[model samples]
Target: MPWTVMPTFESYAQAREAFSWDLPDEFNPAVDFLRKHEDTSRTALRYETPDGGLETYSFDDLDDRSDRLAAALADFGVDAGDRVGVVVPQKPQNPITHLANWKLGAVSVPLTVLFGRDALQYRLADSEATAVVVDPDVRETVEEIRGECPALEHVIELGTTDAVSGEAHAFEDLLESYEPGIDVYDATPETPTAIMYTSGSTGPPKGVRHSHALWLGRAAAAYNYFDRGLEPGETTVWTPADWAWGAALGGTLFAAWHHGCTVVGWPRDGFDPEDAYDLMARHDVTKAFMPPTALRMLTAVDDPEAQYDLSLETFASAGEPLTSEVVDWVEETFADVAINEFYGQTELNLVVGNSSWYETRPGSMGKPLPGYEVRVLDPETREPLGRGEIGELAVTSDDRRVFFDEYWKLPEKTANKRTEDGWFLTGDLVERDDDGYLWFHSRTDDVILTSGYRVGPMEVEEAILHHSDAEQAGVVGVPDETRGEAIKAYVQPATDDYDPDTLREEIRDLVRDRLAEYEYPQHVAFVDELPTTTTGKIQRRSLRERE
Candidate 1:
C-alpha cells in the first residue's frame, strides 16, 4: 500500500491545517521524537552494504547510541556552538555523530571522503572545527594534515579498526563504554545547527550556517509537501550519503528523525541500476529521494519493472532539474506514485517543491513551498520581474523560515548574495509561469548566447532526452568563431548495441528537427557516463574544461 494513499493523513486539508503553519508546542525538531519513542523498538534503520551485510537499528538503538556518543564527545571537551567535522559514508555512524554533536549544542560539519587533503584542510580551517569524526580509511588524510589544523582537538574513527593509533578513538567503543542519558543541552531555534559548504566551481567551498529555526521550518515544509504521510518507524533510503552530507544529514535524516522516520543509507559508489533496484526492494523502503542522475540510471534499465517491487510513496529528486522522461517512467512503473521535484541549495533548504496534493506539471518545479516567499528578480536591477519573465530566483529575507543566516567566515560573499531589501540572490536564472509553476533555466553563467539567441541548456537537453538511444545528455557552450558560442552536447548512450558515430549523427539530426537551428549542438561526444560530482550533478565545469 502506498503510505501517502493510506488514511495516515485524514485528508489533504487536515494535513495542511496541522503542519502548514508553525510546529505545535509539543513538537521539537530534535530530542523530542527520540526521547518520547525510546520504547518503540520498531526498526528505525535497515541498512545493507555492498558485501550484503545487513544492520538493523531500532528507535531505542538509535537513541542509546546517540546518547552514548554524545557523552563521549562531551568527555572529549566538545561544548555548545563548537564545530565538529564528520566524514563518513551512508552508515549507522553518520547520524550517530550528528546526534552527538547536536547533544552538545555544537555545529556538525559534514565532509565527504572523496575530498582530498586540500579540500578537507580548507573546510576544517574555514569552519574552525574543534574535532573531526571520520571513517578509518580516510583518517590518513586527516593525520597527515593535523599539523596545519590547529583547531582540530581530536579525531573519532567510524570503521571496524582505527587507522591511526592512540590519536583516534573507535566510534563503537565510545558508545559501548557509555550509557544513555538525557543530558543533552537545550538548543533554541536561533542556535546555529549546521555549517554546510557549497560546492563552488571557481574557488574553495563557502560555508553557510543554518539555525535551528530554519531546520525546523524545513521539516515542516517537507512534512507538508509529503501530506504528513511519513509515519513513525517507517524506512526512507537515499544515497550518496556524505556527498550532500549537509542536506541529507541536516534536512533528510534530522528532519525525518524528528517526525519519527527511520533513515536508511548505503554505499552509492558506482552507478549500478540493478544494485539500486535490489537495495530498494530488499529494504522495503517507503520514501526514496535521489538526484536526476540516479533516476536516469533507474529508468534506463530493462523493462518488466514489476520484478522489483518498490514500496515508495513519495519519490523525490533534487540537486538539479529532473527530466520529463525520468519522471514519467517512475510514475508509469510505480503505479503512478507521485514523483516530487524540489529546488534548493546548501544555503537554503526546500523553498520550492511538488507536493502530493498539488497537481504536477511536466517541466515545472511546482510552486514555492509553504512558509517561503519566492521572487524572480531582474539580475541587474534587483527588482522583481513580472510573471513569465526569466530572472534570478530569490527568497525573501523577511520570512526567515527558509533563508540562511550567513556564509561563515565570508562576510563579503554573504553581503553580495543578500540584497538591501533582504532578498537572497539564488544566482539561478528561472522563469515563472502565470499559474505559479517555476521552470529552470541554465545557471547564470551557463546561459548560452548563439547568433543573437539566448539558449538554456535544459531546453536543449530536454529535446535530446526524447531520443530513444540517448540515456543522458549535458549541453554546454563551446567557443564559436562566427556565432560567439555554440551548444556542445556530451551524451551517454542507453544501450551498448548502437554505433557511437551513427547515433551522434542521428542525435544531431534529431536536435536539428526538434530545436532551433542555432540551438542544436555542433559538437557531440558519446561517453560511458557524464562526469559527475558525488551528488550526481554533471560537473559542467569539468565538461567545459575538456574543450
Candidate 2:
C-alpha cells in the first residue's frame, strides 16, 4: 500500500515547519486505499452483528460490492454531482454506499440512523438527494417522508427486516444483478465528494459540503493524531461514536482504511460501558477515536482493566474539550496509551490537535495541524489576536484542502462563515498561548455575561463534573434582570442516592472555589437526564429552550 502523509519528523516544531499538504490534481477518497483491487484476503472491516456474530469484509470484497452497488446506482439514474444519502450505523453497507457514491462521482451525504422524521426529511430535502441506502429498520421512517421529499426517487434497503421489494429495491439483489469491475471515476480535487450536516445544536442543521480534497486535507492530521498510523503492531481501530460523525468517519475509519489497517464496528443502541469494555478486549483494539463523553461514561466501570484485557495504544478524543479530571483518569487507566485530544468542527476539522511528538498541556487544544493555519481573531475587527488573547478561532487558508467547499447551496449562510479577507470563522471562542497551544473558552454565543464578568459554560461544567455526584453537566446563560444573564446549570447526578439539595450546594461551592466566585452557577437544577446528540455531546441549545 502507498501510505499518504507519513510522519518523519521527531518533534512537533519540526513537523510544523516542514509539513505541507501535497495532493494530486486528481483525487477520490476510494483511491486512498492504494492496495485495493489486489488484496482480497487482507481484512478491511470487522463488524459485530446484533446476534453477537462477527462479519468481516476485505478490501477486495469492498471493491467488488461497491462496484456492483455503483452500477446499480447508475441504473437508478444517479449521475455525477448527484447526492446519495447513506443513513445507517456502522454496518458494511454504510462504507459500501459511500465508496459507490464516490466511485460514480456522486456526493455522499451521511445521515445518522438516530435522527427522527423531521431531522431526516430536512437533510434529504435540503440536499435534494436522488437516492438513499438505508437499513430495513429505518426504511419505514424514510418511506414516511417520501411525500415531502419530491426529489427522492429510489429507496434501497441495505439490511434484513423483511421489507417488501415493492416499497424499496432489495440492495442485495441489485448488487447481484449488476456486474463488478466498472471503471472508477477520475475526479479532480475540486470534485464534490460529500455534504455533511452539522449537529444543529445552535440552529437548523446546515450542510457543510466539501470536495474530494477534504480526504487529503484530513489524512495528514489523522496520521499525526492517531500516532503516525499507529505503527508497531497489527493496528485494529474502533470507536463507539456513530460513523456519520466526522470524528469517527474521517478520523478513525477512513484514516485506518487508507493506511490498510483493520477497523471494527459494533452497532448498538446506546453506549454500554460493560459491552464497550468487552468488545475492545475481544478485538484487541490498538487505536480509538473516543469522544470525551464516551471516556467519561467508561469511568463508571470499577477496575475495568481487571475485568477486561485491553491492548489499546492510542486513544484519540475530540467533539468536546477534555477536562483535567478526565485527562487524569485516562492517564491512570491506560498505562501504555497515548491520549491525544484534538480540536475541529463539521465545517473545518482536524485543523488543530495534539499528537505523540510533544508533551500535551492539560485542557489545551494542541498546535496547528499540517497544512492548516488556525488563528485567534478579533470577532469584530477580523484581525489576528495576540497569544493568550481570547477571540474567535478562525482558520486562515494556508491550504484550502483543510477547509470545506461551501454550505451546500446556502450562499448566504456560507458567506457568513467567512470574513471579507477570507478567514473561515469557527464561531468558537478560544485562545492560543505563547507556547503554541490553543485553549477553548466557549462558543461565541454560549459565553455567559453575568454581573459584568464573561463566563464560559465549559469551564463551569468542568468544575461541576469535578463533584463526585455530577455524572453530566450542561451549562447555559439564562435571562436575568440583575445580572445580564445568569449562569444556570442542568446537572445529571452520578447516582440516584444523592440528596439533591445538598449536592446542589456542593456543586455551587466547588465551582466557586475552583474558579472565580462569579463563575459558579446561581441556579442548579438536577435532572435525570440531559439532552444530547447521538455522539454523546450535551446539546446546550436544548437546555436553553427549557428556559
Candidate 3:
C-alpha cells in the first residue's frame, strides 16, 4: 500500500456510505502513525525559519525525541490527565511536545505566542496548567506572570538561551538525561488529548477539550475535503496558521502526517505576500490553506502571478467568510488551481466545506461533510428553518465526527450550546438553499437591524470589496436616533493616493446600486487597519465598541 486514500470508492456518495470510523481500545495518534507506516525514513515534518533556514525530520527521529521528552515529563511528576501548557512557535518542538503529551495521556494546552502578558496569565490560571513548555524568547514574559499562576509548578524552556532562576529546566538536558524508552499510555478514544482556546472575540477565551479521537475525525477533512490522496513523499502541505490554532495543528500538521505527507511550518511574523509566495514555489507546495485576511493581502500584491512560480494546486480559506472579490481574484490568479472554502470552529474541526470532488459555488460554504450533518434553526423557536431562510447554524449532536466533549470546565456554557433535542448551536447565522449549499449571513450578534429591516454585514462588506480601491472592509451598525441602528463601514484603502471622500462615496454608491436602500452604509470611515485576532479573524465586536 502506498499511503493513498484508503477505502477508495467510485463516487462521493459511495465514499460517504463506505466511510467507517473504528478506533482501537487504546489509541494514540502518534503511535497509530508509526504503526501504520513501516518505513521510518519517510519525512514527517519540514520546517523553515523566517530568514531562509530549513530543517526536516523523519518519523524515526520524532519517535525517538518524543519518547525522550515523555520520559523526562514522567520524571518531572507529570502524570496522566495533567494539563501541560505549550507556548512554542510552529517549529519541530511544538509537535514534539504535543506527541510527548499524547504518549503520556496528559492534556496539551496550546498557548499562542502572540498573546500579551495578561492574556497569557488568564489562560494559565484558567486551565490550572501544572507545567508549561515555552521557547527562550517568551521566557521573560512567562516569568513575569509566573507568580500569578498558582497551579503552574515547573517551567520547561526550549532553545539555547540564558536560563532563568527558580526551577527552570533546559529542554535539551532532559532529553539527554532521560532514557528514551517508555511504554505508550493506554489512552482510550475518550481520553483528553488537547484543550484549544477560542479567539475570545466576544469575551474571555474558553478552553475546548477534545478527545484523542479528534485525529481520526479529521480524516474526512483531509481525504475528502482537501482531496489530498498523495503518495508518500509526494505531497507538500503548507499553512501559515500558528500551531496553536486548530486549523494548523489538526488541519495541516496532524492531517498531513496521518497520510504520510510532508508538512511545512514557518514563523508567524506578520503576513508578507512576497515571502509567502516564494516559500510555496521554493518548497513545491501542492496544497495550502490560508485565512481570509492573508488571502486578501496576497490579492493586493501587484502582479502576483509574475512574482513567483507558484506550485500550489489546491488552496482553501477559512477563519472567516471568503469575500466574493477574493474568490474571483484566486480564480483569475491561479488559473488551473482549485480553490475550496471550508467552515469549522475550535470545538468542531471541519463540519462544512467544498471539496475538489464537488463544484464550488463562490460565497457558499458548501454542504455537510461525510459523517456530519448541519441544519439551520430559528433562534427563538428552536425549530428547523426552511430552505433560503437565514437562521442559526446547528449540528446534530449524534454526529460523532463533529462534536466536542465539553467546554473544559464550564458546564453552563456547554449546556447552553446544545438544544433540548440534541443539536449544537454554532452561534453563526446562515441559510441553506434548495440545492443544500450553505451560505453565511453573519454572527447572531453581528447582524444589523436598521429601521425595522434586518441586514447581514457580510452582504454590505462584499459589495464594498467589489470596488477596485477597497482592500478590506468591516461593516457594523452604529447608533441612530430615527432608525434603531444605522449601517457604518470601516474601509481600508487599496492605495494611499486615493481621496477618502471620493472612495467613500464610490463605496456607498456601489452598495446602493447592488443592495436594497436600507442595506447601504450611511457612514463610511477610512482607516489604515482593522482589529484582528491572532488567527486573522476580524473583531467586529471591537469595531462596534469603537462606535
Candidate 4:
C-alpha cells in the first residue's frame, strides 16, 4: 500500500512544496492501521523473545484480541476519555492494550517499565488513571503505589485471570470472556488517544495529550526518514528503543504500519551490541530507528560486518544529537545505510528531521520538516529572531498534525508554552545558520538530557533527598564520552554524623531504587552547601558551571 497523501519528490525543496496532510474529519489510528491493513498471511508484528525464539503475529490476531479486550474493558466500567496505563514491554500486548483503549475512545498512557515507584506514581496520579495493564516485572510496583492513586482501580496482570483476586484481573481471561470484535468508537482527528508523560524543569512529570491525528502527523517524516523504502512490502522496520517513548511508538511502530510495512520487535533487559547485530541480521531488518546512544554502544562490537550479515538500508536516530565520530563510523561500517538524525520532543514530534532524499548537514538537524513552520524566537520576548541569533525554537501552534492538544489538565502550563499569537515554545535553544541548518545550543530550562533520556534534575533531586542523611541535592548534566551527557549530583549532608563515603553510595542506591535506572546520578560529590538563588532555590546552572 503506497502512501496516499505523502509525496514522492526528487528534491528537498520539491518535498517541502508538495507536502500536505490529508487528515479526514474522522480518524482513529487503531482502526486505520489494523483494519485498513488487514491481511491473513502477512505478518503485522514479529517479536524476538529473550530465549532466541521468534513470535510472528498477523493483523487479524492483534485486531481480534484488541476487539475482545475492548468489550471486556467497557463491561468493566471503562468509558470514553478514561485513562488506561500500559506498562508492558515491546510485546504484542503493548499494541493490543493501546488498540483496545482507542477502540473505546479512551486514552492510552504509555508508561515505560524503566520508571521505578516514585517515577511511576507521579504519572499515574497526575493522569488520574482508571486502570493499568502491567507485566509481571512491574505488577508489584503498580500494586505498591495503588493506595496513593485513588483514581486507579483495575490492575490487569499478564497472567491467568483466575489467579488474580479483588481488583486484580488476568489479561488473557478478560479477552476470553468476550467474543472477538466490538463496535470501535467513531472518532475525529481531535479525539484524544494517548497521553505520554515527560519530565520538566519544575514540578512532577506532565502528560502530553496527543489526539488521533498524531499518527498522520508523523507519517511524512518516517516515510522519508526510512529512505522512502522504495517498496513498502519489502520494508522490515526494527528498533531497540522501548515502545513507550515517542521515538518508537510514533517514529518506528505506527509509521511503518501506516505505510503497510512490517515491524520487528526485540525487547532486551539491557542493550547488548552483539545481540542487536545478531537480531537484525537474522531478521534481515532493512530500516531502523536506532538511538545515538545505542549506535555508540554498537561501535563496541568487534568486526560486526564480518561477523553478521546485516542488511540495514536506513538507520534513523533521535533522542540525543548524533556526534560526528558516530556519524563517521556508521558511514564506514554500513556502506548502504543512510544515517539520518532528527530532532523533536514529545510535545511536537518529527517537526524537524534529516532525510535520505537530500544532502544532510553533518552537525545540524536538517531544515524544518515539511508541514511544520519552525522559527527561532527570543526566549522571553516571543519575537522572531534573525538568522544568526540564538533563540528557542518555536513551531506554529495551529497544525494539529505537528502540535499537542495541551499538557493534560495543566491549563496554566499549556498557556505558558504558547505566546499571545500562537507558537508552541520548545524549551530547546537553537541557531539557524546561513544555510538554514538548525544548530542546537542549549535548553532554556535545566532539565538534563542524558543518554537521550530527559532526566529532570528535580526528579533526581527528590530521589537523592529521599535519603535520611541527605539535606539539599542539586543535579546537572555534565559532558560525557558515550552518553551525550552524564547526570552529576551535588549533595549536602543533613548532619555531620554520617560518613561521606557511605552517604554517596546510599544516595546512588536510593535514586536507582526510586527512579529509572538510567536517571541515577553517574557522578556524586558531597558538599557543605550548594549554590542557591536569592530565593534559596538550588541553582542547577551554578552547579553545572562548577563542573
CA-lDDT, candidates in order: 0.71, 0.81, 0.78, 0.84
Winner by lDDT: 4
Clash pairs (backbone) in predicted model 4: none
Instruction: List, residue by residue over 213-307, the lDDT tens digit for candidate 3.
Output: 78766754766666745446788888887787777788778888777788888886667878888888888888888776677777767776677
User: What's the lDDT for candidate 3?
Assistant: 0.78
Estimate the TM-score of every prediction. 0.77, 0.81, 0.80, 0.97
lDDT (10s digit) by residue, model 1, range 453-511: 34567666767898899998888887764444677999999999998788888887776
Q: Per-residue lDDT tens digits of candidate 2, residues 1-547? A: 1335365788777877887666676677776653443454688889999899999888888888899999999988899999999998999999899999989999999987866565678889999999999877678879989889989999999743364555788888888899988788888778898999863324456789988777766666778888885442278999998888787888788877777788998998878889998999999998888777677778889878789999888888886667777778878887777888888777886788888788888898888886678778998898999988999999865667568888877888889888888888888899988888899887777766554344557767877898889999999988764444688999999989998789989998887655545567899999999999999989989999999
Superposed model 1: Cα runs more than 4 Å off: 1-29, 159-166, 224-227, 234-237, 240-244, 397-402, 446-547
Clashing pairs in 1: none
Cα lDDT tens digits for candidate 4, 96-131: 999999999999999988889998888999889999
lDDT of 1 at 440: 87
Q: Each prediction's Cα RMSD?
A: 10.9, 10.0, 10.4, 1.8
Clashes counted in candidate 1 amount to 0
Alpha carbon lDDT at 323, candidate 3: 67
**Best candidate, TM-score:** 4
User: What TM-score would you give candidate 2 relative to the actual structure?
Assistant: 0.81
TM-score of structure candidate 1: 0.77
